[model samples]
Target: MNYDHWGRFLAQKVNEHTGLDILKWKNEKKHTWEALSWPDFYDKVNKTALALLDLGVKSGDNVAIWAENMPQWLVADMAVFSIRAVTVPLYANSPEVQAEYILHETESRIVFVGENEQYTKINAIREKLPSLKQVIVFAEPESPEEPDMSFETFVSAGSFANKAEELEKRRRDASMEDLATIIYTSGTTGVPKGVMLTHANFAETLRTHEILLDMNPGDTSIAFLPMSHIFERGWIYMCLNRGMTIYFNHDPREIQTTLAEVRPTFMCTVPRFWEKVYGAVNENINNGPAIKKKIFNWALKVGDSYYMNHKRVKKEPGVMLKLQHAVANAIVYSKVKKKAGLENAKFFPCAGAAIAPEVATFFHRMGIHLMIGYGLSETTATVTVNRYYDFNLASIGKAMPDLEVKVGENNEIMVKGKTVMKGYYKKPIETAEVFDGEWFKTGDAGYFGEDGNLVMTERIKELYKTATGKYVAPNYIEAKLAMDKYIEQIAVFGDRKKYIIALIAPSVQAIKEYAQKMNIAYDNLEELLSHSGIISFFEDRLQKIQREFARFEQIKKFKLLPYPFTVETGELTSTLKLRRKIIFEKYKELIEGMYVD
Candidate 1:
């Protein structure tokens, strides 16, 4: 079915199968579940679409949405799709400069701003957006100072019944080939380019998800990742189509607490969140008395043995393996899963980047099905995923049904499927270079294992040649560094150097513990990062990490960056992928300092 049909189909399912409790926002202390049914959802979408149309939004016009994860954002998105308009979702935390570029490039006619912060951002660059005609804010207007219309005002201006009929009529004509979204690549090198995605692109991805994961109507999902990302966007639609109720996360800071309260059956997250959980667990173990620490360590060893012997190898467990696993799960693994708020989670999909194998194994040992997958935004967010039944911890899994995946001469992954993007918007030459006749060059280097699982090595473009003609894949080195509980972020550099070097960002919790143990006093993050003793500590840690790597891939020199890379900064993309080019340019001075004798 087409993308338009997917939305209508989901809406029909929600109306038939679900009661009023299809979607909820319990975090706000507002019980909105009973009041908002599928009919209500569809009505709002239709009215909102008509409101946008009334504001002169055309069928192909770009309508940008800058908001946190909220019900209104979903409504706005569906409304855009209803009229065959393209939705351009900007990261809520994006800088005004970056947001301005997206808005201007897409030539968005209407922008739905979440609250005051979002409105202020658009207002700052309103003059620069020639095609931007109206600003519809989701928050209630408190005073005359606010320069936007509230969501209530925007919807109230249109006839709900009339708009619903009008949109339903248009929906019948909306084709699978119609452009659904224009997601701007986070622009690691130059200005972000819009990647055009058709309705069929997303629909095909959702179908693949259904095959890989046994998604059903009874399952529930917690939306945590930014909806602006194609990963979450596709997943959200997948849930909607399958008749699953979605709980929108109101505050990311309280995600753990919220997860415990909601107890969702499914979730999607990046590796960093799991890494932080691992860091916390390790820190607690380190702080505990000797006996407790020893027991915890023993339990982990037992758990690892059980996973390797049984799950990884798919062998029948011997008597001793069974005994050890039972003891470990009861004593340690079960407790760990509970603390991580994943006891109720069936299978959590890990994407956006390569998960450290150790962490993946650790979670699997603890009975958490951490399904790791690999894809780019251009691939409609998913290309390969480990099936729930036949998952392998070491592999990213086999290609999805209907997707053609092959490794090139240099082991670069290439994909051809209905889900593959149309091309980069308005840049035919650039698009032509990347998108071959049918297959899209993933730029990611990987190989298909004997078992037919896709194992990603590194990005072909990210690989750098050293002065000695040795090729270094930074991701491989960085993944090893990430296995360290204290190391949060590490970037390797050796483009024209004799030896490799790195910039490290230590975990905040790890740094705090180090400061406490050493009796080092600090006023803030800046002072702690600049401390000579702390720097030496990281140096020693890096040396230890280097020992685990080959000679060429070892990091020879390094510096500790004061702050971690964030989406707010231009260093990282919306999907939490590093923009290496931007980072190298931004930190040229500090990077050069490491090379000087």
Candidate 2:
């Protein structure tokens, strides 16, 4: 792989698949899907590249993409890469201050915004940034403000300039040493730091995945996760490389609708998505008639035996068991799969946080390929992923071929590979701190199981140490409790304390239904949560979920809130990881009250 991984190979791929549909996007106004053939997509990329050239965006200059998941987002990214410029991706929903910080820090001369909201945000903060000069909005804004223009207008401007030769020269000049992208961390701990990844890093990642995963040119993928996130961004790169047809899912709230329509062969998503599906499926079965529950449970057992015992073990199922599996698939699994539009699902890469083993197992039992893996932005997305066969449900699969992964001091997962990021952009001290010799220290605590599978323990900085010197992994506890239908969002706290405590946000609808069924009356949710019977019910549920946990690790007290932790409330990161510090400070009183007893 050379520095021309994107400029050469990607361009070649587009040319090779010129007649094929490369991108699909839903038109919000028309309520129909629009597609772009490889040639059409390539034309846009070329025009966008020439546009950047016209804007005086030279090689090595930083260009910011503050947008959501959309085809234009990739077009702009590819354009930037083709010209060997560094791309700084800000979360589509990033606050003005954060976006301003990234633009200012990178000294970005131009930025591509997704829509009006992003344009407005950047436009409002333009005065604060000395270097930011142009704003390119992906959508046609009602009014094109000064220093900003519609994406179409920007693209059209390149057509008259005749800078096509310059764009080509820059593309040919692309090198592996060129800085590719500067992805800002979600900053669950604090201020976001830009993780600098080079073209070489992406090239190696693409190669490694091609070897480890089963993917083909005609495969279909739905881009549901925000492309600003490395998991999706990197995965999409591989999809393009493999000539996979990608459907851009614009609004995440409508992912289920898009999922059913696309019925994609592959996708990348977070654990929260699966958690919701698992909860919904379980709720329906639990609330249904006894006979239905019994039938569903029986089908699940049959699936487990056939898939886990026979198929997974490479042993043929006996005739009787095969007959049972066929009945289960027809009567239960097939219906569930079709309802969720997972009937065509080949494999889905799940990561970003720990998914409950039970949830992963549920998908596996239903003949769904849910490949659980682990990695970080600094590692270019995936370091380990479960294979199509011979995978351990409890572990985060095997390391990618040729990627060095090992447990380091403090049980931190360490990596030394081509996929590891070059360093944080313009932050030498921070970059130096995350590396020891050649290994990039992944600030996660984990160890390998006896079967050579990586078993993640907890995030090193997030591990809670009790006053009694007991260590508690809150993620393990929270992941388990979150599976309960009532517990929508939970954060465990007990650092230097007697025992663990949790702040829970109950599922409002589920709680309301429970109240109706139990004959508990309440004027409002807050009042309902304060009821003695509700507290006891939650306590009973918590005890049952934590029965396997050590006594010290069990949550001693909990406070249920009527509200959920939201990204807008500063309690969760853009990626939905809990910001423990802010959450603790926000509810200091409630946490203190829990400690009073």
Candidate no. 2 TM-score: 0.97
Off by over 4 Å in 2: 1-3, 212-214
Estimated TM-score for each candidate: 0.93, 0.97
**Per-residue lDDT tens digits of candidate 2, residues 10-62?**
77888667777889999888989999999888889888888888888888999
Model 1 ranges off by over 4 Å: 1-4, 26-35, 141-147, 160-165, 305-308, 311-324, 522-527
* lDDT of candidate 1 at residue 366, scale 0 to 100: 74
Query: Which candidate's lDDT is highest?
Result: 2
On the 0 to 100 scale, the lDDT of residue 558 in model 1 is 82
Q: Can you list the residue pairs that collide in candidate 2?
A: 3-175, 3-176
Best candidate, TM-score: 2
Q: What are the RMSD figures for all models against the true structure?
A: 2.6, 1.6
Q: Residue-pair clashes per candidate, as listed? A: 0, 2
